[model samples]
Target chain A: MSKISRRKFLAGSVAGGAAVMMTPAKKALAAGSFEGFPDGMGVLVDFTRCVGCRTCEAACNKEQNLPAPAKPFDDYSVFDEIHHGQPRRPTSKAYTVVNRYETKEEGPVFRKIQCNHCNEPACLTSCFVNAYTKTPEGAVIYNSKVCVGCRNCMIACPFHIPGYTYESVINPVIKKCIFCYDTRLKEGRPPACVESCPQQVMTFGKRAELMNIAHERMRKNPEKYVDHIYGEKEVGGTGWFYISGVPFEELGFDTHLPKEPIINNVKDFLAVVPMVLAIWPALFTGFHLLATKGKSHGHGDDHSHGEEGH
Target chain B: MKKLATYGIKPHDAEVKADGQKWSLMEKLLLGLTLDQYLDQLKRNKFNWLLALIFAIGIPVIIYRFIFGLGVVTHASYDYPWGLFLGFGLFCMVPLSASGFMLGTTVEIFGRHDFEPIERLALLNGLLGYFFAVVYLLVDLGQPWRLIYPMFVSWGPAAVLFLVGWHVATYLSVQVMEVSTAFFEWIGFPRGYEFIRKGTVGLTVSGIILSTLHQGALGALFTYAPGKVHPLWYSSSFQWIHYFTSSIPAGLCMVISVSTIVILTMKWRCDDRFINNLDRITLSLAKGAAMGLITYLFIKLLAVAHDNEWAYIATGWGAWWLFEMLAGVLLPMFLLAVGIHNKNVLLCRIGAFVTVFGILLNRLNTALITFNWQLYQEIPHMWEIVISITIFAIYVATYRFILNRLPILYQYKAQAVEEGVAVEAEQKAAVNA
Candidate 1:
């Protein structure tokens, strides 16, 4: 420990000569300049364009190879499905769901809830088993093999997207929309849900391009969409952006989500780990030595007294 | 014991039989009752039937969970990701298990050997509490079989659960080693006991280290969800301290509560030394608990003040927080003080019961009630209730089993006699062989 401190001073002078190379690239890109890889695709869901057709729901079920629902996909009555008085969002069996929210002024608004695939996704960061991965192409994929089912991701996701199929005994994985990374998005095609939407509510593009298009549509007809994009800066932005005519809060969005990803707040505590690991052993050992100094070894002869009578 | 009896030895003069012989292993194992009588006694106890009923339901529910998944047993709602299992089992159980280290420090580290008679009891309490906490965690986990994945298969060393996983694993082992010393003594493994004794300082240090990290890390786990946990319950800076400090009281009070239960229901299991020393030990333990409660109270207030949550005091949630303080913290603080000052064993016991309940309420509040503060409240499913109660019953049954068989509250006389012979042989060997 003493020698390292001494060598640090010697290394300081040597560090001056190699300063430029050692510093590495301080990439001074403009804030938000990295709008992800240029070809990285995203989905823009325009609320005004959606007609609650349920075509996309059928397509998604088939595309994901999920189990068929109890009710037929053609049945729009599936929108009224409720559990514990609240409408179902998503489940291990259903990665995406469109729920009808009736407003007094606006009549009814159908909102689709799925994994937002955040730029800095909470589920990806919170997973202790490294089960989640955010690709450069904007899809957040999960590796089920490594998943321990601690459900920290479910707890961390602000959108509450990850669903554990708790009923599956043998193979339980966190089920969520992966933006069709393996099949569709990787091929530069839209997700099956986007491609199957006959109402044309869903639009697929580059995330940055999608954001611009969402804002442009809202600007052209302010009355048709809310002023804000739902996923614009939520938890440090998401691949999916929503344009809702009704307030996002009323549409079951978590309005209280911090602008920064939840992992950012946790960094403060994580930063302290190294400091503690480096300090506690030495510090406490010193305290022990100091506290026990000059005390005749107590209890060396009294191990027998630990017994009393059964 | 058989080896010791070969040389005609007895642990204590009082343990000698009328025939001038030591009790056999069978007699000790059955507590001097014949096998038939012991079985009859077990049948006579209604609690065993109740435990059997719980195991019948719970063990299967647990198996079904592993087979079906976490969704089968729990609602598995995204809003309430953690239910009764983590809330009551992991969070509540771990703090209660803090008794082992807290007492171990009092007697071993601080050199207050007066607490020796009850030390093994405290150690057993801690060991069992932690052991069962892990059992509860296994039942709650989505993929219970891959629990080792976090440790070996995949490492998210940065995550708070990472710390919890590693520390709990390490601390559980530490506690096993700590508690096993008694088993070594009981089983007449003199060399094993000596080996463990030599490493006591190192073990205690590691215990303190692991206890500090894991207790704090459990609180830090909540830090992952800043907005999810309520403001009053959420303090980024002080939350870990709040948990760690409160665990001090929780652990101490747990030992008190367990001792109280044992004295009431299993008095025959305790030897006179334990029963006689228990009241004084309870008072001493309460003193530590009071100190912990006082520290916990101040830090809790500091968290509230740091967050400037004064306005929240008028709300319903604030009232709930106050209820937690009154029952869990302030009331116990006052009761423990009064009990210690007045030397009222009953008051100390009452204080302990309150503190234990307070700890439970605090954990439950953090994990369930105030979780998703803005979201609607979640009433656990009826199935969830049955499962939680059943697992708790299993915990109680296992605790009773160990208390009945192991030299937890009582010493094993046979081991001591064997140890006496071993010491004599070792001395003779040093002189001759």
Candidate 2:
């Protein structure tokens, strides 16, 4: 039964090897420092500008057609709800959430959490079914149909985004902010959350232009901001850049994330794969011939050879 | 079986009975015993009752998980996507099953026939461990039906899991072929056994290839979560190597542990050849385990030094890491060394058990316990724990079932293999007369 399968595998491996050899290592290395696709749109979130009102969250739920909130969006008590010591995070039902982080002097700083939509997304690279896609329009979207629900993306996501719909028995898939990819971002419109914000806390524009605007704001009134864009160079730069009044670490961001993309960390091991596939068969076969040179072969012969030598 | 042996009734180990009558398939399946006697022995065995109790609770919970979904049974949310199912099952079981290739290399590749008596056992261990690991993976996967997506429907060849998926699928087939030789012998299928024998070298070589890549690929999967896995356990440069190297001893020690259990619990099934040569083979396997452990220790230290993580040693996690190394690695290595020096089989067995536990600890530490160190830890749900125990019980029971009937611990004699030819010759002479 397996003889045919392995025969197929042997052919498959050769083709796979050729494919690996054909793909230039330079392209892989280029991805190491890849910031984002040129002309991709991005959101610049200014943490200094927002009131604690969750209009964005309410708009996101309606735009995504998600389930109604347990408490109405106006209920601020949800901010105090902590599960597993973590403040409110995005779930399948709620695509975005606003968390209240208390600062030393500035009272409660309201931080809206959702998918950062990274340029070189860990989720995209970690997926074994090619379920995730980093669109040219700067959105990281996922296909539910092909999703095997391995959850490697959840583990790989540096920002702790992308919740699973574990309640669904038959068709559970990853649920995360897609930057309103199908509905708004594709047509060059701002997401519902961005447009719904009464405080104009977020600016939707070209990623390069947003970077310039962010730096200008920090340069002009340096004391008003923390002088750092949290997503600018984190995990190879997320499309959702953030300029905060407080330090990023204070806002519960993983500040120590590597500047290089997460896939770069895995590249070393990936490089070894082809080498082993190519080398091990001959190497061990050579050992077989050498070890059993004058002795009885492993097959069809036993005790007579057993006591003679190791 | 022990009670049956007292009556001088031998179990099935040949194709034909002593009277040259062909043994029926039913007789072979029942280990040459009547159904009543077979059922009686099973009743007398205390272990079967425990297995029965586990399966009673576990099977329903497993079915319930499918109906209610993974969330009801497991604490697998966004933070901890893999709980005990993968933490203990996939990570721990794969390494412990490494014996297939380890012994395959020793006897088949290197022609160290001295280890031949235990080679089939090692191969079977590999086959079952991997088969059950996939079982655990099936339970853990949210959409287990789409498991073939990585192979047939979709392609994400760049992902570490993609490599893992392909290698495991391929390696499992290879192990099935390797272990089928024993099955063929038990059922009196010479053509199939001979066909498998011709490809033994090819299969063993492929086994080594698949084993190396997949074992390393499992570690490589963690590289995708560099920030999640604790610094003590994470090494981008050496993580795969660490997993591969450590699996060497893990596999070797597992064989030792399994053999020890076999001797203690079901010595009636083991043939004279296996019963006598087991001590020497255990010592030989222990040497290999020792070599692997020392190499693993060196590389583990090198990984920490390579990453320049010595400073983390002073912290709480660092202390815990040190404790793992001392208790699991250093202590076990010392015990094995002392056992070998004294030629003490019992000490070696104790050391092998400790080594097995150490590998379990290492895999669990890498995949679960220390994973998401920065986040709050989540214990597996009650039903999840029950299901995990139940699946393991099934593995143990299946393992015993195969060992009890198959020619794994003992050789099926040659007379049965040549019985057909001998009968044909006699029948021709009688016709002429």
Candidate 3:
């Protein structure tokens, strides 16, 4: 064959291979349009009703069998403490913590931050080792066995909930609230924090139903609460929804977050992966042949002759 | 070297030894110095002692990290997810190691045979840098043994990490293949070297493909955190491009830096061809890096423009961004231009070093310093610093070892090369005719 024909043939084959590799991903994307599991469970937090009593904190601690906090949950002094100039969210030590936002207009609106258990959770999607799993019941749980601790999920998280036990010498798992999935939520029971709330601030139900209930409460009490449900459309809709009299941003929510899932940001790159894999062998092989066509195969052979010695 | 008196230490010198006696492996390994002289040279370099000190202190800490877990070594804050290991090792080191593919393309594939003298050094530098980056990653991982879990255990096909994991693994192999030819030359294995050479086009093409994907994949890893990585530093659509493009200069500048350092420190080990061509190669490499930096600068702005991030430029992060641009991108670019214009290799050398520092600062900023701009800044633990420096010391040591022995700095003339050339022609003829 002429050099041109060979080059054309290789390039054509590579293009064909790339097309083959990309077809499935494109098909999957066209078919999968983020229709979340319809019956997924969710939590609705009425921030207006929360008094920062720390009842939910104590309940989460008790249910998870976590180490006791330095101060008692009843000691209200913990609420005033701030680290890194921001209110506390979930940590390895604290699975769920309700931070009190002292708003000028709304008095005190307590916003609870934990794993939003996003419908399309970044944590679940970013884990390379399958460390995290988002169950149908709407809890994102993690396994420590395969956790490499690269912490890309920590970077990916919009709410910044997953905490690593850097203090542990061995088996430092990512610690976060599993929404009581293992012990309670899976059995159709409310999470420990929700069940333990004194003011009934948390309402647990099917995620789709809870969203409707959140909208209903907002409509019924338009004068009493903010119109927004914090997690309803944030990061592709989290299972946890928050309603407060104060604006969501004031309560330390990442209001700038896009409505699409974090994984959606990576789709453009992932779409190219298989294409490169299938096309590169032929593409570069063709380049090699074309570049070296008229030149002596002497240098090329000399090159590999050198490689084998290693 | 005593064996290379007139040849100098550059790669361009085609001078045959006056007596036509090839230096044996042992003499080359000893830099043509006898055993005692080699030992005396080792004792003379105080930097070796410093490296010893760092490993003495840091190696134990690494062991401690493995035994006790990452928590003992790093602050392990929930907010600051990745600390020194990832911030410096994986993120920074990978880009610097882009030298392999960059040089490989220049010397081998594109027929820029002028770069052949310094090509092996660049390839060795890349291979060692990447190998050690993985070393640091192993220390930082919670389950270091299960590092291959992404490949075999359970795959998260859709994850950005899936891309990073697969690409890094594959790219590491491609680099190994690219570097192996030098090893084969050193070891006198003609067949192995010839086999790999036959696959050169395939390997080089694979190198480009792998380098492009993983370099971009590293940036794509950040896309998973749109809200966390500052808007000025992060562009969802353009982050991959910024990283991939900057890496071109970053990798090229790294070759210039490594070559410069090798010439200055290990001149004795380098053959005449490498030593004589060092200055010209440095200037040429700097020119390439300058173009890369200019492209990088334009793309960074384009990324900002694409995102309409004009508002971020006025903030403190913007100032930080400008500083990165001024020092990292623009200053080296100007210096490189001047260096290339005046044919001043020293200025090009300086430009290369500056560009290297700039790449380091950029990676550190993206991975550690400016990550979670809204969150508090984290100072890496003392142990973390110790381990990071120690690993870097090991990288330098390995690089030196390879440069000393491999045909990277000095080509080997062996019996097989003549026969191998004939064999290769036959193979090509068989394939074509």
Task: Please compute DockQ, using alpha carbons, for every candidate against the native two-chain complex.
Answer: 0.27, 0.46, 0.42
lDDT tens digits, residues A31-102, model 3?
Answer: 244746788898898888888888888989999999999898889787788987877778888998888888
lDDT per residue (tens digit) for residues B102-168 in model 1: 8776665555667877888888888888888888888777678899997789876556787788778
Q: TM-score of candidate 2 restricted to chain B?
A: 0.95
The stretch of ten residues in a row with the least summed lDDT in candidate 3 chain B is B7-16
Shift of residue A93 alpha carbon in model 3, Å: 2.5
> In candidate 3, how many Å is residue B137 off?
0.7
lDDT of 3 by residue, B1-433 (tens): 3223222222221112223555566765664445654565466678889888888998898788777777777887778878888889989998998988898877555656677777777777777878888998888877677788887887776676766777677767767887887776665666777666555545566667778887888888888888888888888887888888989999999888887787777675675667877888888888899999999999899989989999999998899999999999999999999999999998998998899899888888888888888878889989999989888888888877777667677656433122233443443343332
lDDT head-to-head 1 vs 3, winner: 3
| Segments of candidate 3 deviating more than 4 angstroms | A1-31, A278-283, A297-310, B1-35, B415-433
Interface RMSD of each: 10.3, 5.4, 5.1
DockQ measured for candidate 1? 0.27
Write the number of the candidate with greater TM-score, choosing between 1 and 2.
Answer: 2
Candidate 1 regions with alpha-carbon error over 4 angstroms? A1-40, A218-225, A298-301, A305-310, B1-27, B43-46, B56-72, B411-433
lDDT to native, each model: 0.75, 0.85, 0.76
Select the stronger candidate by lDDT from 1 and 2: 2
- Chain A TM-scores of each predicted structure, in the order given, are 0.83, 0.88, 0.87
lDDT measured at residue B326 in model 2 versus the true structure, 0 to 100: 91
Q: Whose DockQ is greatest here? A: 2
